[model samples]
Target: MKLLRISDLRAADIEAIWSLVGGGDASLRGTIAWSFEGNGIRTRTTFIQAFRDLGLAFTELPNLLKTDERACDLAGYLDPFYDAYVVREANHARLAEFAAASRRPVVNAMSSQGHPCEVLTDAFYLHTRVAPLERARVCLWGPTTNVLRSWHELAGVLGFPLRHACDRRFHETLDKVTFTEAAILPADVVITDGWPQGADDPRWSLTEEHLARMGSPMLLPTPPFSIGRELAFDPLRYRGFAGYAQKQLLLPVHKAILRHVLSR
Candidate 1:
């Protein structure tokens, strides 16, 4: 999982992503994934340089969820995109085709269905630092992307109950998943992140009031927003705090999770 193009991230955020990758295993030392804009030679050249330096595969994909066919077509190029691709908010049929077509594994990437890797890591992190996954009440606040998909996947796999709070527009109908518009409620695990959008301004945050509403001990992967201040310091408020499963470093996390699942 070298590269991704979720609208939730920006070019500047690439540094933090690099940090995670750089600190990962030597097997992934050179793997790279990045967002692309097909402007002209300069943009392509820059992207090439970045990949060359990082020793990663390259790809260009539309960041928005507009047409299914276009998304499928774009995802079909996973070989050129990345050694392992993560197609966020894409169609599962397209993902299946990409996986079938590519000799290399194209992870569920991401769709409305589930983000297996994200959930795996989130559950692993929670299990490691806080408590058993099955013994927790996880609360998710945000839209239906890899995050919510992850929650559903984690809950199903670990036999945990998950409650979701998202704006109506981003909410989807699912049998196992329950949705609500009210503010986030506390649970054993509380994960909150933003909707993928054009602008990634740090000011868009879940307020202190929102945080106060949670009833139980918690885990926050990344906070609800990307403010300049570090969210890790607020440990006093929440019993056990963890950064949101860093999706930026999805490659290593994805690979680890894939190995875990496929190995089984």
Candidate 2:
């Protein structure tokens, strides 16, 4: 019952999660233990609410688990006291290893490799509000990062058309991501992750003019999105900007995920 990545679940699994969205199974009383080192304000706060909604007791792991050995050992160390582990840390290898060592279920909230929950939430939004994911044309605009990787993994699993609009310098090694900004034109939905740190290129930025060019595709900028960087202008001015509206479903989505994980 470990959710390490998006490919771990399929379309049916997503549907199952959707079916269980609004109402949760509270009979399964499970306590959760969580630790965070990644930069995800939206992810952290939303899950805390999810914990409370499910009536699940949760505790924050202290910052003492620094070393890889101690971090992996934490699963067995806290196994008796905690029912489940939620970790949102930076190291992909360490996260995988810690999940391996844990006897209880491990939920990867975010990592250097992917953000499964966020991807799943976004996919759920598309399926429920926009279109079936199999037919949706997706375009992600930004540098290659964890969220993008998760989307890529999801695309491979769901058989959807995913076009990445990024600068050639950023994705020189990535074959699937296109070099030109024209990749956003034919998309049904356009999404974005954070711009590469210390790098600012307006060419890759999303502006009203860009959305207008795309003919008003659903625009979802993954959070911690910058104003002048990933977004060239204020996003609230654009009608297609559905970032906030889309993320509002995170509560139910996270509740479903927690229910599924803890029940198993």
Candidate 3:
């Protein structure tokens, strides 16, 4: 059996996975569930819908803070029942440790280090809504947080042009990557996850003035966006904005990946 981490998947494999999911082959079914300990309505809703659509059994473990020993024990317990595990937690190190201990394939929902699944959905959105990914200019605004880290990882694999307009403090020390102040104006897609939890940085906010300058580019703010913090106006008013539809794109790819893992 092989571990199916997004970092290990090739570009072709990603395309194939999405294609498999979009085809909606009802024959594919399995026991899929998530073990998370935070508020992730969008991710949770999307996974449940994906599992239901694919005719797979879905369950969510109770939100419990497990000790390392208990976490490992639970993984062994779930090994006999589940085909895949989606984990969302604040600690990346612990999540990585859990994935290593788990017998089944582990899908990272989100962690302190990265959010691969969300980035995968972003890729799918660009593939369908915007230009070809190889030629697309993606501008990431805000901190070098988990989402940006995942994008950085993805850029290495996919060879896409990813530029960032971030605070000097949040800038990543990646080689050959461009960090620009003018990225918002020329970007094909402008993405932001907003500021860190309690920090208020007005300069990073996606104000109406900034949007006006972003000529016809797609706007994707990672879900549960704060109106005043991330965007000045309601994103629902923008023609290029992606809300639930962006989330919907994740379903097929997620289902496809799970199905592929099960077959292997």
lDDT of 3: 0.73
lDDT of 2 by residue, 7-44 (tens): 78776666677888778546458789888885578888
Instruction: Judging by lDDT, tell me the better candidate of 1 and 3.
Output: 3
The number of the candidate with the highest TM-score is 2
- lDDT agreement with native, every candidate: 0.48, 0.79, 0.73
Any residue pairs clashing in model 3, and if so which? none
Q: Write model 1 residue lDDT over 118-226, tens digit each, in one string.
A: 4544555566557766566667766555556666654553445678866666566654467888655567766765456542333334445455666545647442444
Each candidate's number of clashing pairs is: 7, 0, 0
Number of residue pairs clashing in candidate 1, backbone atoms closer than 3 angstroms, sequence gap of 3 or more or interchain? 7
Score every model by TM-score: 0.52, 0.89, 0.88
In terms of lDDT, the poorest run of 10 residues in model 2 is 172-181
